[model samples]
Target: MADDNPGFSDPVTLFQDVEDLKAQIARLTGLIDRLTAGGGDDPAGPGDGDTGAPAQDADAEGEEEDGYPPFILLLDSPAYDEELRALIEWVEGVLVPGYLAEPSSDAHWCHLWFEHPVAVGRLHALWLAWQELTEPATCGYTGPSTWHRDHLDPCMRELRGRGGPFGGCTKNEHQIAHRQPSLVPSAWRMAES
Candidate 1:
């Protein structure tokens, strides 16, 4: 049967191809760094608790419920901007396709709910930078909680009062209710007893 045909490429092969692609990416990245620094010292390798290493078996098992495998992409200063863009594009393009093709594969499984805390923090910082660049008035913003709350609170109240998807909810509450659940076991809700 075609399903059992030896000539057919196995799922393992596809995964290996993905790994090979990632290695190629790493090599290309190294080359880019070398060129950028004009042959300066290689940036420090991944340190402890860094995102460069594969997730531990325990972590993978713990995260299984989220439907995505966990992996890391450690980026030093020079590689941050370009690598983040490439990583986001990979999530949208390559990773999504692979997940759709074989939802059960390790790659698909781990990546489905993959979380790189460092990358996320970096992205958040970048977002703040962009926001500042685009809207300077939004700067010095104490957000929603402060003695300045009186000034901001009514504005936020008026906005929330206007009624939308989050009509009456605070941002924190909205995020908690609507944000994507993490792959970590903690994110899983226990079945009703």
Candidate 2:
């Protein structure tokens, strides 16, 4: 039967080839997970603690001084006008107020300790939704989801180097739209109708 088709290969060789491919895929997947999950380091690591000394010194120095580290917000894309507006509203109304005040206020610092994975996961979900809404080829282009998964570090670094938040970090759009899911009803509903 193998000889009947000119393109046919040996069954044992095919099986071996498939096994090798599977092994390689597994290895690659493990690597991706490690790389994405803060490379084995704790997401909310030691840096988040208030050393107390420096802050106290700064407080003693001057209350009006620019002591607080600036905030960073990473948006997935500018194309999803409705969702983008909704996200901006969410940042201003909900997320910023909830996370940037009181006990969790330290999380506002880009350099401070944080649940990096959780933040990254949330950004990733937003990125996915953004891709679905903007990219015509995406499965949910006309569906509900409207966010994308944007990496914060690069965007933050760019913002820092620019000396302000208006540097236009749109260059990282590709990275922002990766590793996202196809559907996100909550995000879709959150967008302006």
Candidate 3:
């Protein structure tokens, strides 16, 4: 018998695809929940814990939900999934460009940025903060600067400092340590010379 579908024709590949789609759907559902239900303070990011004040809608909306941002859906948090890949790309293309200018740091970003669980968690939280802080004040936000101060700063310190994610890695630009050992085992890193 000929296989009508070469890829999914095999039960194993079909099962894997089904599982991936289900995971994607679950992640999206959680994202929707975060958007509507307001985010709670994720343990990873700064400004965690209650203020003993009313929760602003913008503040609530920025919290990372259980499934969250979906960059963390896998056991190893690989960026092979399209949505997860897009998130990492945004951090690489947009966030890094907007904030840091050190070529060595950018090299560090290329090398160690994605291979740390804490980095991934903090970045996702920071992105949520960005979303909340960028909304207008009428949306109950003070503005995007809060994200810079509260979320972005500390994460930057951890991800970019000498003792940060790139610790023990080469400090050369136009060159990277190239996927040196990740601080956290869960994040998937790619080596590009």
Candidate 4:
């Protein structure tokens, strides 16, 4: 008799469970639709896009789940390995390419970094930091903000400083003062692997 809140217990709980299950079903249905129907016009489907992460709402802004362009992988996410591999590929494939090509400040005009030991180590750490600072709900700033302020600026200053890695390839009169300070091309090539 004391448990007389009977209606609040079983039936209500069952109803709540049913609602949750329904919501999950609806979400899963949407995923299947996207995967089967394609990301856009092409019939190749969302998997064809394969940009690693799932698609985001074109209208949504500042409320992204993984922050932005540089997504940090959460172990619970199904796309964990995919996203991480993508990030690694971008850093190696695109981000650090300039450094390998020309390890001078003149290479990219004031922010380029050469593939020196110190530079490579710093950029690797910077990349990792980017992943951490851009977590969906953890960091204080947005992705670009965190990258420029926290990871990019400081690391760039250090890695391209007059005494920093890449021998501080600062743009003086727009000339590469030194022709690649350290870390021979062969070494950087090996590191790329």
Candidate 5:
């Protein structure tokens, strides 16, 4: 049998790839759990008392205040639309051709994925991480692997999975007939008791 995808040569290679993916998922899950609980070993997490605030570096706040657009959801920022356009370009030129697998019901996609807020958010995040990690000067040799394991694979899984934003979409199809899901009202909007 001829293997179409040159990336995976044989059945054993494919099996190994699956095993590697499983290991990566396990590691990522463990890392998330550890970070969420504010360090794995601690019963009483970071910040004063049991506040469980994420432990941030002293420079973390400064970085944001310096007008660094670390996220694409900055609608108020002047760069929002430009950043979004760049994201779309990268998705089309790099991600779709390079990373996206053949779409099936289990792993669906839509050409007009930007219409979905969830897809936009996730893809933006993935693109941002890709920029940071793939820079050889900044992240070094292990960066690409870390990005794939910690970011790309997970983001793609969530975006393309059965329960993902593209769940209702089909391969190469862009159906906006169904509106995006609505969120519950914010607590601030509710009247005080």
Candidate 6:
């Protein structure tokens, strides 16, 4: 029989690629389920399409459901409180001590960072990317450097840049003020005559 697929000379390599794709698909399916079910907090509840298994049981079964969720979903999730606690721990323990430099006119930071939604979202995303990239089995030795160069610096620039989310705050002060940018009403919200 003729080879239907080309460029995959090694069967082992092809099998590994297929396995990786399967894992990716599983993760994406779980994400979509969570998104559609509005956080998928109650896996045993209707519309989750599960076998009435609790969410924690799925975790115990070694399913890949414990990955970090998007910030919006995290907010809506029942696990929000727990995730927030962990985020605070990561930010204070790892991010603040290691990544944060002295706040100045050029580099703005806030003591009340958790109060700012934009800062929280950005930092959470950065932390998630850090976790994924820094996994030794995943990205190996270059992971941390790649995370710093690609994710950390850019996210910090957006979070701490001039007129950024923490623009009103300072190193030791929690100004807790933000200007509402001008925006037109959404089309869905417009009153129909």
Winner by lDDT: 5
Worst 10 residues of 1 by lDDT: 105-114
**Candidate 6's TM-score:** 0.59
Model 1: per-residue lDDT, tens digit, 1-193?
Answer: 7577775567776655565455446545644554465443433322121222232332333223222222223445444454455456644564346423432212112231224343244333333233222221222222212212333233323322333223323423332133345566443355432
Q: Look at candidate 5 and give me any clashing residue pairs.
A: none
Per-residue C-alpha lDDT of model 6 across residues 23-125, encoded as one tens digit per residue:
4465456556666666457442332323222223433222335432445324544466556677888899989999899888888988788888888888878
* Residue ranges of candidate 6 with Cα displaced over 4 Å: 1-74, 182-193
Screening candidate 1 with a backbone cut-off below 3 angstroms (N, C-alpha, C), the clashing residue pairs are 68-109, 68-110, 68-112, 68-113, 69-109, 69-110, 69-111
Candidate 2, TM-score vs. the true structure?
Answer: 0.20
**Regions of model 2 farther than 4 Å from truth:** 1-79, 93-150, 163-193
Highest TM-score, which number?
6
CA-lDDT, candidates in order: 0.36, 0.35, 0.52, 0.49, 0.67, 0.66
Estimate, for each residue in 1-193, the C-alpha lDDT of model 3 and write its tens digit.
Answer: 4377566667866765565455446545544544555554552222222211123332233234432333344424233344346557768877978887764634345345565655666776676566545544212333454456668888887766666655545644322444366676443444332
Q: What is the lDDT of residue 59 in candidate 3?
A: 29
lDDT of 1 at 119: 28
lDDT per residue for candidate 5 within 1-193, as digits (tens), equals: 3657777668776875675565456545544554577643543233221111123432443225322335666564455666678789889988999998788988888888988877888998888677656654344455677789889999999988888878878765676645565888778778653
Show model 4 residue runs off by greater than 4 Å.
Answer: 1-88, 92-115, 140-143, 168-193
In model 4, the Cα lDDT at residue 12 comes to: 54
Which sections of candidate 1 miss by over 4 Å?
A: 1-78, 100-193
Task: Flag the better candidate by TM-score, 3 or 6.
Answer: 6
